[model samples]
Structure formats: C-alpha cells, structure tokens
Target: MSRRRSKILVVSALAVLLLAWEGAVVLTGAQASWPFPSGIIRSGFAITADGTLLVALAGSLQRVITGFLVGALVGIPTGIAMGLLPWVNLAMRPVTESLRSIAPIAWIPLAILWLGVQGNAALFVVAYAAVFPFILNAAQAARAVDRNHLRAARALGAGPGLILRAVVVPSTLPTIFTAARIALAIAWSSIIAAELALGVKIESGGRSVAGLGQLMVATLYVKRDVNALVFGMLVIGLVSFLIDAVLRRLRDTLLPWARR
Candidate 1:
C-alpha cells in the first residue's frame, strides 16, 4: 500500500481500538474504578513523575546495549571465520546448531543459578539470545561472497586480509548490518525476559537496579495496577518499534549500493 494510505489506516485502526477499549471499560463498571484512556495517561504520568519509569527504562536499555555490543563483537568475527575457513565451519556447525536449538528461556534458570538474578545474569541472557542470529546471518553472507571477486583480488597480488577487507567485507556489509539489527531486537526481547525472570540489581546510592519488565510484573500481578501495566507495555512496544524503524532507515541510507 502507499505510504499515505498506510499511515491513515494505522491511525484509523488505533482510533477504533481506543474507542472500543473505552466503551468496554465504561460498560463493564471497571471505568468507575479505573477509567480507560485517561487512566492510562494518568498512570503513565505518575510513573514518569516519580522517576520509576525512567529508571527502569535506563536500566533495561543499558543491559540490552551492553549485551548486544558484546555479542556482536564476538559473533561477527566468529561468523566471518566460519564462512571463510572450511575447517572452522565444519568444526563449529554442529556445536553452534546444538546450542542454538536450546531456547533462550532455557538459559534463564541456569543463568540465574550461575550468575544470580542480577545485572550480569540479564546481560548473559541477552547476549545468548543475540549471538546466534548474528553468527548465522553473517556467516551465510560472508560465505556467499563472490568467488570471482576473490579471484580477481588474488590475481592482483592482494593478500587474504586485503581481499577480505576490500571485497568480502564490502559485499557482505548489508547482510551483516541486517543481522546486527535482528540481533538487537533479539537482545531487547531477551533483556526483558531476563528482567522479568531475574530482576536486575543495579547498585546505586541506595536504589537497586530496576527494569520495565520487572515493573510490569510487579504492577500487573503483585500490585494489580492495570493502568501502569498497560503503560509499561505501550512504552516497550513504542520504543522497540522506533528503534527498528531507525535501524532500517540507517541501513537503507548507508548501504544504498547493496540495493543494486
């Protein structure tokens, strides 16, 4: 669909959803206790005013960013090696496949047991979730590098390192970027899961580490705060959507040649 039509549809759908939600709340007698639209807004404002939401957001972002960076740093190079070297690919494929087959959630209990329910545990989980996708995509992209290009570089007396930097890396740049973006999304999801399963314990002056996932669980299940829960959820959705959009835009702009 055209961009304008798509935007209009999205807006219309959102408006309808809001109206339906408001109507349901009003008719169910729940509105008398906790209204819809306004209730969510007020709850969001209250959490923001108290700095709880900001704290949680910051903590969550930190964990995801740290884990993503660490994972990419290791995963990209390992993937490149696997793609370029037959020996490495043969050796690592079985192990990589086996480990990746295990769900990220499965690592939670072990992460908690080994690292405890803290910042490190959350980071480890995020890294685990992010790494495999990055490795798989990067390896495939690198492996698909044109053999003709490699031959041309070699005929020019270019060394292996030079050919990699000049040809293989360039050719695979777009795919690597796409993989990194996917890894970031996975890391974000993993961090949230970790936060819910194993709360972060960021030691500040006296405040402990907090996260949106933990706040969500506390508000929804423990405190029975529906408005706050919804607000937290909306924040997560909006932020993730925004980040992905930006990444896509960046990929298109920076790797225009890849489109050809």
Candidate 2:
C-alpha cells in the first residue's frame, strides 16, 4: 500500500480506538479515575500552557542524549578493539556477554547507591542500556570488513592509519548508525524507568526529579490526577515515535546505500 494510504488507515484505527475508549469510560462511569480521550486532550493543553510538559521533556531529553553519547563513545572503541584484535575479543567477550545479560533496570539500585538519587544515577542507567547494542553491532560490522579491501589498501602502500580512515570507518558507519538508533531507543526507555524509580524512592522524602516519568508518577500517585497521567503517557509515546522517525530519516539520508 502507499505511504499516504497506510497513514490514513493508522489514523482511522487510532480514532476508532480512542472513541471506543472514551465511550467505555463514560458508559462504565469510570471517567473520574480512568479519564476519557477528551479529558486527556484538555490536560495536554493545560500542561503545555503551564510549561510543565516542556520542562519535564527537557530534563528527560538532556539525560538521554548525554548518556547515549557517553555510551557510544566508549562502546564503539571497545567494540572496534574486540573486532580487530583476537586477544581483545577473547578477554572481553566473556565479560560483555555476562554483563549484557543483566537488564539495565536491574542496575538501578546499584546506580542509585553509587551515584545517589541525582541525575547522574539516571545517566548511569541510560548509558548502561545504550552501550551493549553499540558494542555488539560495531563488532559485527568491523569483523565483516573485507580482508581483500584491506589487502588492496596495504598493497597500495597505505599505512594502518590510512587504511583505517579510508576503509574501515566507511564500511563500519552504516552498522554504527544502526546501532545508534537502537541504543538511543533503549537509552530513552532506560531514562524513563530510572527517573520513575528515582521519583518514587526520593519523593517520599520531599525530593523529586524532573522527567516525564516523574510527572506521570506525581500525577498518578500524589496529585491523583488521571488526566495528567494519561497526558504524560501520550506525550511519551509521541516523543518516542518522533525520535525513531528522525533517526530513520537520518539513516536513510546519510547512508542511502545501506537502505534495504
């Protein structure tokens, strides 16, 4: 089907679902706690007008970007080393495999213990969530680099640095970008989970973190505002969709040859 047609179908489906949800809530007399689509829309407007949503979004984005960058910076080099060097792979594979088996959410308690309830704790979780995808994908990409290409470059009197710059990097970039897109999604999710955990753990002591997750938690638990909670959930879904769309467009534009 055409893209336009697919989008129309999706929009129609969403509208039907929303209408069903609104009707169910109204008919069941659960509007007070569950809220209808209309109430959530009004909450979105109120939060946007008051700047609450923007502030929470800014904090979440800041942590996600910073932590993802850190993860990519470290993971790419480590992955390259593992791919290029037999000894490095032998030494690190076991450790990486073991660590990556553990979920990022599982690290939240240790992160909080080591870094406290500050933004740094959330950053640690996001970075942890982001790093494994880069390492795994980059290693696969680097190892798949054609030996004939390297040999040809060497025969042409290219040094290790020259061949790496001219051959290795270009060949690896598509996979690196793919890894980046995956890691970023993981990082975004990790930040939200970390922030929500932090908010619950710390807010009881009269301290709070600023994030969409925190906002959701506050609205649901403390303020008992179902509309705001639903609004925050919708904002999270929209932001995630936008981020993925932007990354997919960037990948298609910059690495057109990699497109399937």
Candidate 3:
C-alpha cells in the first residue's frame, strides 16, 4: 500500500514486539540477563552521550568507504573490459570465477596473515567482498548492452573511445550503480565480520580496533554487558538501513530513467 501506511505498520509491529519482550522480562525476572527494550534504549543513549557510538560508527564507515571505493575502481573497469573483449573474458573468467566462489569471510584468516590484525585486514576483506558484485553486475550489464547501439555508433565513424563514451557507458551505468549498492551492503557486512574476527584474535600487546563489531564483542565478552551488545547490534541495523535508503535515493535522483 502507501509508504506511510507501511511505515506505520512496521513501527506498530516493532512496538508490539518490544512491549511483549518487556512484559516477558518483567514477568520472568530476567532483566539481569535479558534487557528490556527500554534498557536497550537507555544503553544506546549512554553510549551516544559518551561518544562511543559515534566513534565506532565513524571507524566502521571509514573502512567500508575506503575498501568499497578501491573495489569499485578495480572491479568496474575490469568487468567492462571483460564484457567488451572476448579474449579478456576468456583469460580472466577462470580466475574471477574461482575467487568469487570463496566467501569473503573465508578470506579473513588470509587477510590477517598477510596484513595482520589491523585495519588493513578488515579493508582487504571488505574489498574482496565488494569487488565481485561489481564485476559480475558490470559484466552482465555491459554484455546486455544493445548491439545495435554499438553498431550505430560505429557506423557513424565512432572510434573505440568514442563508442565507449557515447554508447557503452550510458548503457552500463545503471547496472553499475546497482552493483555499487550491492557492493556497499556486502562491504558493511564484511567489515563487521572482519572487525569481529580481529577483535577476538587480538592479544594483550596487539592493537585494539574500533568498530561496532568490536564494541559488541567487548561488551558481550569482556564487560558482559548485554544491553550494550544489543545496542550495538541495533546501531548496526539502523546504520545499514539508513545507508541503503540514501543509496536508493541517490540512484533514483541520478538515474531516474533506470528506476525499476
């Protein structure tokens, strides 16, 4: 139905669920172990007041943006080349296919070994997670470009660069943007997973990383703070939702003709 109605329904459902949870905790005397929704909100407010939430969010966003940009820079051009040139596709397909088959999470250990437990390890994982979608979507989009358009451009004496600029780029950009959205989601997940893994592996002498994942891990394991852990999880979900909404808005604004 309407967007407003859908949002109201979602808010109502969440309120019902939270109230039920709060009632259950009150009835069962489990507030010590299981926090109520109010407790979680209070914890969130405490963290925000102390600047913890903002710092963690900044660290996570920084890594995600850097890694995703690097992935896009590398993947989009490679994908476009593969789609445009059969020989390039033939040469790279086997490697790209093999690499993509490995989950980004699976690369955490290798990243740790190569880059250590620092931010670079998380960046590597995020880039790995972000790149494949870009490559796959860009390639598919390029391949799906109307051959007639290319032919028409060529018939008008367009060279390779001219045809690419006039024909291929416009045709492929919508899908590239779609790929960017998918890659961004993946990058967020990858960075969190990478950060969590690194946090767990950190030694007393090793450098401590800061992110929502690390905050959750610390709260859950070190401090035994369930409220903070839940707050961090909620923050992650909210941030992801907001980022996706912004990306969708950008796509709509820039590529109105490509709206699905």
Q: What is the lDDT of candidate 3?
A: 0.88
TM-scores for candidates 1 onward, in order? 0.88, 0.92, 0.92
For model 2, the superposed segments whose C-alpha errors exceed 4 Å read: 1-16
Q: In model 1, which regions exceed 4 Å deviation?
A: 1-16, 31-35, 200-209
Candidate 3 least-lDDT 10 residues: 200-209
Instruction: For each of the candidates, give the backbone clash count.
Output: 1, 0, 0
Q: Give the top-scoring candidate (lDDT).
A: 2
The C-alpha RMSD in Å for every predicted model, in order, reads 3.4, 2.2, 2.3
CA lDDT for candidate 2: 0.89
Q: How close is candidate 2 to the true structure, as a TM-score?
A: 0.92
**lDDT (tens digit, per residue) of candidate 2 on 1-260:** 99999999999999999899999998999978887889888888998999888998999999999999999999998998888778999999999999999999899888989998877889999999999999999899889999899899999999989988999899999999999999998998889999998889766777664887887777777878788887788788888889999999999999999987
TM-score of 1: 0.88
Query: What local lDDT does model 2 show for residue 198?
Result: 86
Tell me which of candidates 2 and 3 scores higher on lDDT: 2
Instruction: Give the per-residue lDDT digits (tens) of candidate 1, residues 1-260.
Output: 99999999999999999989888887887954564887889899999999999998998999899999988888898898899889999999999999999878678878877986666788898998889988998899989999899889999999988998899889888989989889998888888888877642332223354788877766755567788877888899888897799988888899998654
